[model samples]
Target: MLVVKQALPCETVDFPLSSETQRFINICLGVPVGQGYGLTETCAGAAFSEWDDISVGRVGPPLPCCYVKLISWEEGGYRISDSPMPRGEVVIGGHSITKGYFNNEAKTNEVYKVDERGIRWFYTGDIGQFHPDGCVEIIDRKKDIVKLQHGEYVSLGKVESALQTSNYVDNIMVYADPFHSYCVALVVPPHQALEKWAQNSGISYKDIEELCHNDQAIKEVQQSLSKAAKAARLEKFEIPAKIILLPEPWTPESGLVTAALKLKREQLKAKFKDDLNKLYQ
Candidate 1:
């Protein structure tokens, strides 16, 4: 039996594997894949993928005895209201759905609304759609889609995914700045691995700061960024023309990363506002 887990968009290399180990696996072993999805509001195991390439970012069709729908909203946003649709929020209502929030009726009322039909539905914050082939493709999180200068929608996840494919990158956070033409990235490298590589290649550097400021090292990082952009299939506008190498990793103590290690994008942007301004200037 074989099991594979797709790398996260923010993860540059096989995190569980060492740099040398990853190279060996990629050269000798085949690809790896796996699937699982759940919502904090939903109990767990709401949807998942059993087959390969069913659809990217989909939680497969609803499980047996589960009900899913794409409900239309009177307001601007569309929602997975009740099923049979190509797009909308992913709402689930069935035995698996949670009844309501604890001691927070108002919060519960906002998501678990009762329709005229008297049926209960849990409004999943994720936006997605069901495919013709019976798969679900998560388009974007309700909050992750940013309108570009041209009014086109860009998925931050897509751009971040591209950046993560770079061999030199450890993790990255990509976000749009209202004042810039393109996006920007706060890049974190696998310092230990990169230092080893640098040493092995006879590229001496005093420290990470020196490496980041080194013209040749910057060029190598840029090349990795280009490769990531290509792998992610990003539009020209979506690519970050500028990247800032962070001096340190984002952590909960720094209030830059979430408990789950996800970037606190808004906070990161605000924290690096001056650096970003310098780039634009």
Candidate 2:
């Protein structure tokens, strides 16, 4: 017999969680899982979604111990004057905030600020939008953005996050080249999902590597990617024009990702230089 832990009424996530992932988790666990937004500098208590909010992608209003502010970044096209919702770089000020990084004055001076009222503020590089309900939703980041040949900027992190919600995708790394008009992706397909897809399509494959090279398999994965991107309302240029499927999972041991599972972009780009060239071709 198998045993399972009792489902609690509420669960919380600290890292970025997609709306689709959150909904799926809520359905699977039979509990309301809310997302919280905060950094280590804020003592991890900036804002949290209410369990009953029922809306996706909100990190709730600012907590009593902290206050949240948004300032415009013109280069990124985010502004406090954005209609319907205000969007800008999220700054947190409160009693519980950290002073600065230990013995890193230059780095500390870049992000930490003191207001005229003697209140301390930390300039979180995370881009956010404040909804009418006063809740904050993380929309982008200050880094990991690329400009395409057409001069339009795309946020690589946002694209990856949206596409990773696809059932066929275990992980994804989106690449953009300034010389190329379109973006391309390197996707790590879920083994079980790809196997099931192959079976359903009446395709025989000796291994995952062979299957990844199959034209039909590649087409299906691309279709899945396009569907997810459209569902997420990504702009037309933001959608990848091509993709390279990797049979192997990127791991910390592989040096493609950090211990925290964050992508090491430079390493990945270097490792797949030839593949990326082919993609552009």
Candidate 3:
């Protein structure tokens, strides 16, 4: 079994890689990889890592063809202009961005706005933070922002990203109960890793459903998830208060995710209404 691979310093120009992926490349290839960032609307050319910097979580500065701005979001109660690092939802302008959505005037008008400068800015729906050195760090998606009962905003995507840093977790979905004070999760643990863990920890379960219901497994999962959340610096409210292990992979065919693997929120809620409801109770 032989494998042919590209040598050190992979040629990645118009595509952005995650910081985690970047780290893995650095370890395996022993050289930094080029990185880039953009949205589908912009033809995937907003920014790139020309410096070949292996710095984790940096997507570099905006491209010359794009005009990037971070505006204050009043509803979230946090303003980028008010912050020193300038964290806010990423807004873009320039010829690269589309004029508006096709045949959907109302939807287009909602996200596309012309500023006083006469530049049409499209709300990217992605949150990012400005670094001192001018690099952009993508935090999470704006759609994942959820408001807690205490008026605190929680980014479920960010929480999920944090929890996924654990090896035992294969996939996760964090759900915020708007009607309640805390959060919950639909967890998909790595099958082999979980089984090995159960054996080592002196726990017993015959199947995925039984494993999900195992008290010891649940306790470990909860603790590890909480630890990961804390490491990601998420607020207490953003952490899940309870979790329902599904132990099944979600695919586009499963009606839970899109072809791009983006979660379909409505479909998931409808599909797992019972599991979600049980968590609240």
TM-score per candidate, chains pooled:
0.72, 0.85, 0.87
Worst 10 residues of 1 by lDDT: 8-17
TM-score of 2: 0.85
**What lDDT score belongs to each candidate, Candidate 1 first?**
0.66, 0.90, 0.80
Which prediction has more favorable TM-score, 1 or 3? 3
Q: Which digits, one per residue and each the tens of the lDDT, describe model 1 over residues 1-281?
A: 54546542221211122334434444444433323455666677566655443223445666675667765542325555435556777787776768888999998988996668766678876677777766665555766767766565667876776678787778788777655567777788888866766787789888887776666666677678877687667788887777777658778899988776777878987898898776666
- The residue pairs that clash in candidate 3, if any, are none
Candidate 2 global Cα RMSD: 3.0
Order of quality (lDDT): 2, 3, 1
Question: What are the RMSDs of all candidates, in order?
Answer: 6.7, 3.0, 2.8
Error of model 2, residue 167, in angstroms: 3.1
The best candidate in terms of TM-score: 3
Displacement of residue 26 (Cα, Å) in model 2 is 5.6
lDDT of 1: 0.66
| Candidate 2 segments exceeding 4 Å error | 1-7, 21-30, 199-206
Please write out the lDDT profile of model 2 over residues 153-258, one tens digit for every residue: 9999999988987898988999999898999999999999999989998999999999999999999999999999999999999999999899999999999998
> How many backbone clashes are present in model 2?
0
